[model samples]
Structures are given as structure tokens and as C-alpha cells.
Target: MTDQPSTDRLSEARAALATAMALHEQGDLEGAEAGYRAVLALEYRATDVLPLLAGLLGRLSRAEDALIAWEQLLAIAPDHAVALHEKGLTLHWLGRTGEAVAALEQACALDPHNAIAIGNLAVVLADAGRNHAAIGQFRRALALQSDNLHLRHQLRRLGAASVPFWHIPMMNDAPRNDAFEAAITAAIAVAGPDARVLDIGAGSGLLSLIAARAGAQHVVACEMEPLIAEMAQQIVAQNGYADRITVHAKPSTDLAVGVELDVPAQILVSEILSSDLLTEKVLDTFEDAHRRLLAPDALVIPRAATAMGCLVASETLADYAFVGEVSGFDLSPFTDFAQQRLPIHGTMTAWQRLSDDHELVRLDLTQAKHDAVLTRLRIPVTASGRAIGIVQWMHIDLWPGVTFDNHPDRYTDGGWLQILHSFPTPVDVIAGETLDIAVGHDRITLILLPLTQ
Candidate 1:
């Protein structure tokens, strides 16, 4: 190249870079992107400019382009922490969780003190369902910045996600525990010490401990939540049942006949029922156990669960269930965003049931498979008022002699609460009338709707 031409090319590159920066500041993203591309074509500080271009692409919601730009930057500066972190975030947004984790791990390794990178790594790990590794990353981040609220929240969320929903209330209710233990002890006498026990959803490893205390010889337990699994491990050791019970930190879906257990269990005990029957994926979990994890004719604990609820009318709750015009504005349309389900502490909340208790849904836990379900029914109103929603509870048949429930009428001070399944809109109902409703499961969620009547 001639000296004169090289000088002209350098000047042009500098001018393009300056114009790009100015346009970027003015929020003219398209103009800025064009100028940056022109500068990059001249190969002037391409590594530095690449990150800038990638960031702009991300802000523009052009994730795929952003990812490509970041990957190119990484090719030039392989250990660049920021590039790795950005690339990982982009990958995660693209739903490529495994690659996202690998990139974030590299970022964390290169910059061990970068709390942001560590936090991102933890999140992607959790998204990939590697809760144990996610917990480790969270703990490492916490060790560096103990007072980080975001990290603490993540740790607690993961911990809670691991525990079965029923465990919280069961832990809180001493009376219920006593009743269940008494019934379990009786059943163990009939099942005998030689029974091969399987405890699914082993929250704090309590049920397995109970079985051990009742003299069962072999016990296998599986917990879907990692934090809870760790806690259950500790509790089992403390209770001296570690030798008898083997706790697997995985869902029932991961268990196998000859792998996790010596064989399919003879007495299957799982306490995974949510306050609302279908919300916890209990139907799927139980079916998997019956089909693969348990032997034929295995004695399943909580043999069946029924979702019991009563229609409710409350002016206090109507404001929560619906939105309407106020102060001369047409704001009623905001009601479309009302919550489908609201968790309420049964004893703490002041609300009245307006109809007789009815069965909303029932799950037979012993079934080998369950088809997706939605059904329509009519609920009679006992009082004349604005019907806001339905307050629902659970009834569990733990074993032949054992049973437990969080009845909205009398149960108090439990971790599990009677949830308020709100209607899409407030409906005016007269005393002694009926409201037609639709109820079912969308595989992973419970569906409740008040039909037009």
C-alpha cells in the first residue's frame, strides 16, 4: 500500500469511529451501527470495538447478532471476562442453557472476584436444573459479598423450590404430625420391618426417619430439590437413619428399578401433594413412580388426594379480584391482569366461605398415568353477595389408617395455606343460586375459571 493511501485510510477510520460514538450517544442506534461497521471494516482496534458493537446489538434486542459479535471478540481475547460474561448471558437468553453455563464458568474462573459473573453462573446452573452446582456457586458468591440481597434471595428461592409444598405446613403443624405418626406407626406394624420402603419427596428426610423408627429394613428416598436434599441428608444422619435410608437428590422421574434402588420398592411413600392437588406436578411424579420406580402392588402412601374448596364472597377480596373505574377514569380493563391464585395464610386472613365445601379436583396417586384434565361443574351459592373467588384446601389419605388435611374451616398455624383461586371477574350472585365453573390442570398448572352462566 502507498503511504498516502494508508494515511487517508487511518483518517477515515478515526472519523467513522467518532461519528459512531456520537450517534450512539444520540440514541440513533441504526446510524451508530452502520458507522461502527464501517470503522470495523478498517480493522482499527477491532477487539475493543467488537464489545461495544455487541452491547449495542443486545440493547437493540438483536441477540443472535450480539452473540456472534461477542463470540468473535472472545476468539481474539479468549480470557476476556466481560466478553465471556456477555456471551453467556446472550446464550442463556437464547435458551442454550448448557453453553451459557460453560461460558459463565469461564468468566468466573478468569475473574474470581466478579460477583456479577458468579451470580449469573449460579442462575444459569439453576436454569439447567443443576441445583447442587448452583447452590455451590451461590455460596461462593455469598462468601465474597455476604450482604448481597439478590444473592440471598436466589439462595432462598432455590432452597424453597427444593422442598415439597406440603412439607412447610407439615413441619408447622404438630397436631397433624402426631396424627400422621400415630397412623404411620400402625401401618408399619402391618407392613412389617422387612418391607422395602420408598419415600418420595423426602422433605427433611422425616418420613424415612419415621419408617426407620418403625423398623423398616431397607428405605430409599428421592427429593427433587437440592437444598432440601442436603437438609434431609443432615437430618437423616442426626436421626441415625442414614444407614437404612438412601436419599437421592433427584425427582422420582430419575429413579430406576436397579439403579437408584435395588429393585422397585414394595411400600412406596411419597408426600408431594400440594395444597392444591395438581400444582406440584404430583400427578406426573406419582405416575412415574408407579410405572418405573415402584413394584406392582406397592403400597403407596397418601393413596389419594382430593382438592376441597368452597365458593367465597367477600367485598374486601373483590378489590383484589377485579379492577374498575375510579376517580372518573376507565380503568376497569386492568382487571384482566388479576391473579389466578393467591396464597393466603388460613388463620391470618379474614374471609368467609359463601358455599358448602365441594370437591374441585381429585388425584389418585396410585395411578400409573394421568391424562390432562379440565371439567365443568356448578357451585351453589349459600349467600347473596358479590362472589370474588374460591378458597381451596387439601385432603390427603396418607395410608390406610393415616390421613391429613389443611381444612380451611379449622386448620391453623401451618406452612401450607388455603389458596384463594380468584375469578377472572367479579360476579353478582343471589342467595341459593349456582355458579357454573371450569376446573382442571394445564399439565404444570391448575386452571380455574368461572363460566358465563
Candidate 2:
């Protein structure tokens, strides 16, 4: 014979819970919320009833009330995965990114097999700016739910967005690959099969693999991008060069002679030169390698690089470099803020040369140190018009009898593009006249300014 009052209280609580569920299903959120609170006041199934209340509050856009309900549930059931997951999502919606990441991480750990919870954690991690960790979690979630388009899109958005679009075209560039392979082969022949080789900016591990295939016994490679480095490692393993090539996901500056490399490298291979020759900080990287990582007599591929260009006049390019009145309004002041440099595929854009090619700047990579330089250059005009800018290309001296140039005339389908060094304003000149300009480098950028007569 149970106590009549106790049994009556149980029956009332059950009835209240059933009514709350029915109201919630019928879209009466306010009534459902009241009924849930009534059940909680009766001290019945708090762990279960709190979730219903918190979730309803979330739907109602009452984040503060929902947070309070979730916190109350967490206090009673600290290890509850559902409570933690919902709490984390609420915090994220409120822009409490750090706390959201912490809570979601806890939920993920508690429910390791829950792909949705893991993906939620990844979202919070991304908001917290923990990109690498977010990438890891996204990958884990993808492994379980590979067909989920949202997870795949997020992964690609983070992973592929950081990689330059030119990487694929660069890899498929046959002429560039051939030139590098020839240089690597020649270098290995001179240094012998057992020589130590170091590859800087080891993108996709191509250069390191080239050295390995050329019979170099040991090779060390470094890439600063973590995702790219992982791909390079995978590619190296796929090509059976894993034993000979070691890829490190770090910058060249982070490498040490005795730690990453067993001995000083006898051959250094790198192709960090940008289209402008120095924009990639090639001078600084080479100087550091020469000082710390390489042997005094180490042979450096692409021993010298030159910035070559010819004066050009193009109405097409002028439109991109200069601005004037638009819709009866004077926008000429915007011309003063024009871009100093623009990249264009040589074959794709229409432009005419006004003067012959001239050397703008040259970098001797073998040199241990470099200083900024500026010098006056006088270019003889051939067919003169409005000189909008100079169209620039690169000439690389890889090794003896091995050189590569992406001259706008003969090079196409390669990664490099011809740069247009635009003048602030166009200069009109006549044929058979001389155009004098100052040319040099500030260690990272080419300087080409037309001198006022």
C-alpha cells in the first residue's frame, strides 16, 4: 500500500510532461515552455525536461534563457554529451567562440563516434581561428560521413583556399619540369651519388623527388604550408622516394644543419623566384641558406636570375592602369591610386612593344649577401606611342647549359605570368628617341620609374 499523496504527485508530473510534449508538437511553444517548467517544479525527470526547455528557448531566439537552462542541466549531468553539444552551439551563436570551442571539444571527446558533434566542434574551432585543429576535426568527421556535402565543402573551403590556383598548372608545366630535372641531374653528376641535397620551398616534393631520381642518396625538403607539406609527403611516398627524400612541414629558416640535415648540403635546389624575381624573398632565403644550411662550395641551381622587360603601349592595359571621367563625373583622382603592378598572361592580353628588351634587375643567387641597388637605364624606342608601362618576364640560369625563360613570345601554359609595371601616367614619345628610366630592386620589388626630362 503506497502513500496516496506520493502516488498522486507522480501522476500529476507525468500528465504535465505529456501535455508539454503535445503542446510543443502543436507549435504552442509558450504553452509548452510553461508546462515543462511545471514538470521541473514537480521535481520529475529534470535531466530530460531541461533539454526540452533549453531547445525550445533556442528556437524562440532566447539565447540567454537557453544558456541558463543548459547550464542548469550541465550542473546536474556534467558528462552529458547532448547537454554539452547544445550548450556549445548556443555559445557559438552568441559569439562566445572560445568557450564554444571548449564545450564542443568536450562533447566531441565524450561522443567520439558522433560525426555531427565532431563537425560542430570543427565549426567552433574554425570560428576560434584554430585552422589546423579545425582541419583535423573536419577530416575526422569526413572519414565517418564521407558523403556529407557540408563537411566536404567546409574542408575544401579551408584546405584548397589557402593554396594558390597556379600550383596545378605549374606542376603540369612540362618545359619547366624538364629544365629543373636537367639541372638536378647535372648537379648530382658533379656532386656524386652520395651527395647531400637540400630543396627549399619543396612544393609537392617535386624537386626533392627529382634529386632522388637523379641518384642523390639523401635529400632534405621543406615547405612552410602544412597542408602542402602533407601532400608532398604523400606524393613522395607514392613515387617510392620516401627513403631518399625527407619532407618537413616548415620554412627553410626553421631548418638546422645538424638537426634536419645530417651534414651541410653539398647541393641546394630552390625555385622560389616569383615572376618579378624577388617578390618571394629569394634574396633573404638564399643568404640564410648560404650562411647556415649549405656548404661553402655548394652548387645552387638557378645560379642567377634576371628581370627582363620591354616598353609597351596598350590601350587595353591603359584602361586597367588609369581612370578618368565616368558617367559625367570626374574620377581622374582615382588614377593617382592605380595599381603599381599587374599580372597578365602574355598570350591572353593584347599589347604592343614600344622598345626592345632591357635588363631591369639581376640577382646572383650564389652571392652570400645582397644590397639594394638603383641605376639609370636608357632604352631606345623602336615604335613609340603612349608608353603605359613595361612588360616584364624572367630569365633563369639554372646551371651550365640549363636555363629557363618565360618570355611572353614562346612561353605558354606555364605557371609564370608577365608583369606589367605601370607608370602613374602615360608617356608619349616618338620613334628613334631615347627613354631614360631608373631601374633597381629594393631586395623584394623591382623599381622602374621614368625620369622626367
On lDDT, the candidate that comes out on top is: 2
Evaluated against the true structure, the overall lDDT of model 1 is 0.82
Per residue, candidate 2 scores C-alpha lDDT tens digits across 1-453 of 133336778899999999999999999999999999998888888999999999999999999899999999999989999999999999999999899988988998999999999999988887787777788999999999999999999999877765788788888999999999999999999999899999999888899998999999899999998888989999999999899999999999999988999999999999888877888889999999999999999999989999999999999999999999899998989998998899888888999989988988988999999999999999999996999989999999999999999999888788888999998889997899999999999998999989962
Task: At residue 363, give the lDDT of candidate 2.
Answer: 89
> CA lDDT of 345 in candidate 2?
84
**TM-score, per-candidate, Cα-based:** 0.70, 0.91
lDDT of each: 0.82, 0.92
RMSD of each predicted structure: 6.5, 3.1
- Residue pairs with colliding backbones in model 1 are 162-225, 169-415, 302-398
Clashes found in each candidate (C-alpha, N, C closer than 3 A): 3, 0
